[model samples]
Structures are given as structure tokens and as C-alpha cells.
Target: MSILIDGLLAILAIYLALQSLLAPRLSQSVFLFFAFGLALALAWVRLGAVDVAITEAAIAAGFLGVLFLDALRDFSSTISEKHNNTEAIQSSASRKKIKTFLLPRLAFGVGLGLFLLISLEAIWQIPQGGGLTAAAESMLPESGVEHPVTAVLLNFRAYDTWLEIGVILLGLLAIFVTGGIKIYTKPDVVAKDPLLRQVILFFTPVLFLFGAFLLYIGKSGPGGAFQAAVLWGAIGILLHLGGKPVFAMIPRWVGQLVLIMGLGFFLLMGFVFMSGGATLFEYPKAYAGTLILIVETLAAISIAAALTAIYANLNQMKEEPKENESAN
Candidate 1:
């Protein structure tokens, strides 16, 4: 049964990948890429890697799909019939007149020789990263999570999680500091297309249920803070794009405080706990589970807010101010 499922999923993945590569419409290709991601997630699950399946599903199928759909909608006007039709003309001309590289023949020979030598060395080199059994075993007890990857993500490699949060927050800040904020309610942005509105309405409830399930299932298998939060963020972005939710701005102070609160809480908790000197962020073995839960909750909220704020700001930048025609 498992082998049959894996084989089917692998074939689906290949089909989606090929469709994505061949599709002429950019939006169509983007959606095919999303299908490719979903199929890859299924392949992971079939291979008994539930944790990787969930993470890939969240990052690729959920978050990335929403990003591409929204951005492609914005670019739809910029891509018109003239641009779409020019490819055929260019391809025919290119076939008729294939130009040689302007590089000197001697330099081309030297470059080809160097590339062959490097390719041979690369083929012969032994990869060092395949063995993680020792690291995984050492961290598993400290992780309190069943999946080794989740354990590493939330506990053993918590520092990477901390820095990734910072990177996301920094990206949000940079978007705002530039004129990239479109903080008004452009609720009709995607509603202008009824098909998208229908799609969003259909998927919103499913996403909410799935995201919550992922969060609840974290302790046992693959689902966890990052995956659940990303799913939530994708749902929010979709609803906002579909005219169901309006983008709004809060006071600068509130935004800044919320932005850092997760990291601050995490760092402070570590300081308090590690004072006994096992290591930084170390809780007593008895309390480790509870402490990790607290940290994950904060991390989830922080990531969701950071992503939603970016969506709000991007809309703010694109929106035109409307005059108040409200009743006097």
C-alpha cells in the first residue's frame, strides 16, 4: 500500500512540475507549481516522513501559493496580449539567427577545461552531512517532541528559529520604512475577479481547520508552531486579497513592541532558566516541556503578525486615498 501511494505521488509530482515548466500563462504556471508542492508533500508522507511533509506543505503549498497568487494578480495588468504574443516571434527569429558567444575562442577552451576538471572533482567528492544520528540522539531527549526535525527546529536549533523571526521582522520593517506600505483597505483588490473570490471562500474554512489540526498534532508527530503559523498567515493573506478583510495600521510603538516581544520573551525566559547553569535556554528537565510550549505559542503569534503586517503594508503602498463622502 505504502509503495503504491509513493509511486502515485511521485508521478503526480513529475506531472505538475512538467506542467509548471511548460505553461505559458504565468499565473497558470504559478498554480501548477503549487500543485507540484502539494504532490511533493504527499510523496514525503508516503515515504514515512510526516514531519517533512507537513513543513513542505505549509511552506510551499500554503504560504508560497498565496504569495504567488496575490502577486500575480497585481501583475496581471502589466502582462498583456502584446507581451504574451511576442514569444513566438522571438523564438522563430532566434532559431534563424543563433549568435555565438562573444568570448574569445581561446578563453572558451580554457573555461571548458576548467569546468570539466571541477565537474570530475565534484563527482568524486564525499559529502559530509549525511550522518546526523549522533546529533539527533543527543538532542531528542531535550526536544520533548517525537519527530527529530521538529525537536531540532523548536529546541536544539532554537537559535536558528530566533534569527529567522528577526529576519522576517526586519523584512517587514524595511517594507514600511520604504514607501512600500499600502495600509488602507483595498478590499476589492482580488474581488475584481469573481473566480478568485469563489476560490478563497471555498478554501478559507478548510485552511482554518487544517491549520488548527497541525498545531494540535505537534506534540505527537510533524505539525508545530512554524507550520501552523504559516498556514494561518496564508489564510489571512488570501482573505485580505479576496476583499473579505481590510488592511489597517496601528501605532508605530505598538507594532515595534509586538515585533520584538516573542524574541524578548524567549531570551528573557532562557536567562531566567539557565541561571542554574546547565546552558542558555535550558529549563529544568521537569519543566522543559511547559517552557517549550510557552515559547512555541509566542513564536506562532509573532510569525503570524509579522506576515500579516507585511500584507497590510504592501496594500497600503498600492492604494489610492479616497475622499470622505461620509454624511456630514
Candidate 2:
């Protein structure tokens, strides 16, 4: 059974890779890749790797799937191209001229060959020296978290996580900045969908609250920064799709300051620790939960705004005075 399951998963992964490479429409590819992620999570769980499975399911299956779909939506053609689910041709007579594509093919082949050669050596031999499980076992008691990976994420490799948060913030800033120049349009109106609209309106707030709850619970459980951020972002997306007000065109200073507040405050906290003769970001256990909760909440708010702004790129809008001043 185990062998069969693994083989099926391998086949699914191969199929997903091909679908992504060959799908004429990008949307199909993204959703198929998401299915691939689900398969990967299953495989991880079978291997007794819960952390990797959670990451695969939550980070890749959920958040990455949404992110890719969002990107596909953004790249939507001027006219919606409707595609039929027709059987794909297995062999192509020819595709775009080879001279233009040959170089990329050659480069990809070389890269894949080298990667395989390097990877095989590592996979075939068992490491005789330090192993991750041993290191994690040694560090768990000192980490103050039951889950080893969480301990590593928050404590052992905190600086790495902090920098990653910075990268996320930068990516959000770039999206918002570039999105400002984008033409914003209201989503297509659905006719006589009062029942569905009412249903959505009724439960949307509840969902938002649930997402917040997940984020808060993350401190003690399998959830955390990424999961919470995605949930919060999902609420904003739902609000936007439901045609609710989903933007805040604040002053540039306000936006910039809000964007940096999490990192700024984190750095200040680190400075305080360092001033007390502790190393950089060597957060005292005393302030751990409080500091983490604060950072998480701020991050959630900033992330929500950035995600909403991706859809609603309202540039700086001048307030319109009452009625006929311009006409006069």
C-alpha cells in the first residue's frame, strides 16, 4: 500500500508538472499545481513529517495557490479566452521556431543534468556526521516551544525569519507601488444574485473573525505568521469581491510608515536587548509572548492593506468639494 501510494503521488507530480508546462491557459496550471501541493502534503504526512506537511498544505496548498491565482487574474488578457477541456495533443508537429527556443532548451537541459548529478550524490549516501533530528532534539528544551520547527522558526533561526518578513514587506510595497499606476475597474456585476450576496454579507465578518482567531492561536499551535496573514488577506479579498469598500488612500507618509512599523519596532526591540549586553535579536524569554503577539498583529494589519491594495489601486485622490465650484 505504501509503495503504491508513493508511486501514485509520483505520477501525479509528473502530470502536474506537465500540465503547468503545457497548459495554454495559466489558471488551469495554477489550480493543478495546487492539487500537486495537496499530494505533496499527503506524502509528507506518510513520511511522519508533520511540519513539512503543514507547510505544504497551508503555505503552498492554500496561500501559494491563492497567490498564483491572483497573479493569473492580474495577467488576464484583454478579452477573456474561453477554453474547452479538450484532449491535448501528445506530439506537436512543431512549435514556435526552434532557433528562438533552442538556446533556452539547451540551457535548461544543462542545468537539469548538473542538478541531477549533484543531487544523486547527496541522496545515495547517508550523512555520518550531524543530523537535523539530533540537533532538534537537543534544542527543544531550550526553545520553550513543544514543536521543534516552531522553536527554530521563532528562536534558533529568528534572524532569518525576520529578514524573510522584510522581504515579504518589500514585495508588498512593490506590488502596491506598481499597482498605483494600474487602471482599477469594478468587478463584473452578477445579476439577481441577492441570495448569494446576502449569504456572503452575513458570514463575511464571521470569517474575518475566524481568521484573526487562527492567527492568535498560532502562538501555541500549528498556525503562525503566514497562515494568519493569508487568512486576513483572504477576508480583504472576500470583501473586495463582495463589492464592499476595500481601500484606504492615506497620505504617502502614512503608508510608508505603516509599512515599516513592524520591522521598525522589531529593530527597536532588538536594540533594547543589545543595549542590555544581549546579542542582536536575542529576545529575552520574559518578553517573548508579548513581543511576538504585538508583532503578529501589526503584521496582520499591514498585510491586509497590501493585499486589498493589490486589487484596489486607488492612487492619491483629491477630495471633491460640494457641487458646482468647478462648473462656475
Question: What is the per-residue lDDT of model 1 for residues 72-177, given as tens digits with 9 covering 90 to 100?
Answer: 7467544454564576456656544333322355688899999989998998896777698797988777677666766677677777877888888898889788
Each model's lDDT:
0.73, 0.64
What is the C-alpha RMSD, rounded to one decimal, of candidate 2? 6.9
Off by over 4 Å in 1: 1-15, 76-130, 186-212, 238-252, 320-328
TM for every model, in the order presented, reads 0.72, 0.72
Q: Which candidate is the best by lDDT?
A: 1
lDDT of 1 at 224: 79
- Candidate 2's displacement at residue 135, Å, is 3.8
What lDDT is reached at residue 280 by model 1?
72
